[model samples]
Target: MESMMSFASDLKSVSPLTSGCALIGGVVVLLFIKKVAISAYKTFLRPAIDFTKLGKWAVVTGATDGIGKAYAFELAKRGVNVVIISRTESKLEAVKKEIDDKKYGVEVKYVVCDYGKFDTKARDMIAKELEGLEIGVLINNVGASYRYPRYFHELPKEEIQHLLTMNVDSTVWMTEMVLKGMVERKKGAIVNLSSAAARYTQPLLAEYGACKSFIEKFSCSLNAEYSGKGITCQCQAPFFVATKLAKMRKSWSVPTPEEYCAQGIKWIGYPDDIVSPFWIHATAGWVLLTIPQALTTAHFTQVLGGLRKRGIAKDANGGVSPQKTKKN
Candidate 1:
């Protein structure tokens, strides 16, 4: 009887260290549950902002094709005119025609300047185009990445310059052009396209990811500063969007540009600074947030490295490598 009692006592004992870990785990789970509940409410039940009331026109950089174009179309359907900006003149004209001819019945205009080489002159040109427009929205969708996935050092000086100018400089400049109008009117919305890479550490695509991360941080601060002024600034982050930049065909996990933009447009004018518009991605995000940061980073590194290798081999004869990215 004595021996059996001693064995039972040993079975019931738990180390103090184990007890502390269990307590911490319980706290983390509760926090995660709260976040998910809030997210579900915002995503499913929260009403969207009525954009037609914001202004007469919405401006989208990189609006010739892909997500940018789709976003432009989405807004037009909601009765906002579109100002399209892209590098290629022919593509610009084509987009304008598509919108006009298809009877989107909204005014479509273009300002052609390569975001890759954007400078003071380019900024001035875009600002001039924006003048006198009842601008309600600005979509900073232009972005740059390596011809393929390249490490930070592996990227050339010129390529880095282009990436910075397109991704960072163009966004700030366009925002500067439109922000005053919004401030004066006390009504507007700004959507800056960011990437899930900002949330997920991508190893080989360091600079691109960093630039996207900068956009998210930058948009968040701006929203906080301007929300009281009647402006909604959003930084949208998505994973595996099917675009030319991504170079991957669409799947259930990867949405087409049109599909992605539909969700994105619905999310406009929401109070949230950072929003994952896709329901599937949002659900997956909840699970990922529960994971340990160190483990996720390690896993992302391996996955992105494999993607880089595959991209390099596919583009081996194309002079430039393929960059895994969303609508650029």
Candidate 2:
């Protein structure tokens, strides 16, 4: 009886509102813990796809830095040779050299191709270069966004054209170029990097988000059509990671490219066509998607509008952002 009384006294029963608030808080904490635990297990413990078993060669676009570069090295470590493509020859060569020196013990080759402007001859060259390779994996990681988000109508004509071609057309054509080889071989994995922004409306980034959404839908259908033939198409939709293209620095919210790519590589052959491979990214996505669409869009647009203002000021300082003189 004394023990019972002591326990009851310690409880110090509170008002119903206080108890209700405490209960809710506890539930939220538990849910967050569960999500974190599950995501950590998936990121660190899951067995990565045996990429070498699929083929000898892996090709990555936009491989000079960030996620693309990280994936190229990850594949090389798995004893697969890599072919990297990017617009800057110097940057590509530097990545290739880094792969070589890191002693991945796999061949590292690079192709220089710019996605901002479509070039028939360059496309043919890429195809020709890949013609004889026993390609196993294709990482369609090249992508672009607005220099800063703005209303769709406010975007410059050149910027619109660039984003459409770079973000959408490049993925389509590159996949077409590589997919036939995979189908014929009857064994391959293709990882197409999309954006989490696609899952919800991004008012200031309408076209960019739309293109990513298209990539997700396209990857799912493509996988269904070809999975029976031993091809796996994965469309990964990451929320954000610090990269030059994103114009952001690495943070807890924005994982470094290496960390993101490591988790991403582990998710190859993952059952879902769409994925947020990083732990924090997946958790943030779940939370954001639960909010009302109107609320989310309103908040996002305001944030992006600020970025647009800053971008405009910077470009003005830099003398109109150096428009390319080349037609290509």
Best model per lDDT: 2
Determine which window of 10 residues in candidate 2 has minimal summed lDDT: 319-328
In the range 1-328, model 1's lDDT, one tens digit per residue, is 9999998888579787887999999999999899888877776777667788999999999999889999988988888899999999999999898888878678988989899878888888888888999999999999976677767887779988888898999888889899999999999999999988888777788888889999999999999999999998999988878889887799998999998888888788876899889888887776888899899988878877777687666667364434433223
- The global C-alpha lDDT for each of the candidates, from Candidate 1 onward, is 0.86, 0.87
Candidate 2 similarity to native, TM-score: 0.84
TM, every model: 0.85, 0.84
Deviation from native of the Cα of residue 41 in model 1, angstroms: 3.6
Report the C-alpha displacement of residue 80, candidate 2, in angstroms: 0.6
lDDT at position 130, candidate 2: 92
Residue-level lDDT of model 2, residues 46-135, one tens digit each, is 889788888989999999988999999899998999999999999998899899998978999899899887568878989998989999
**After superposition, which runs of candidate 2 have C-alpha atoms over 4 Å from their true positions?**
1-41, 319-328
**Model 1 root-mean-square deviation:** 6.1
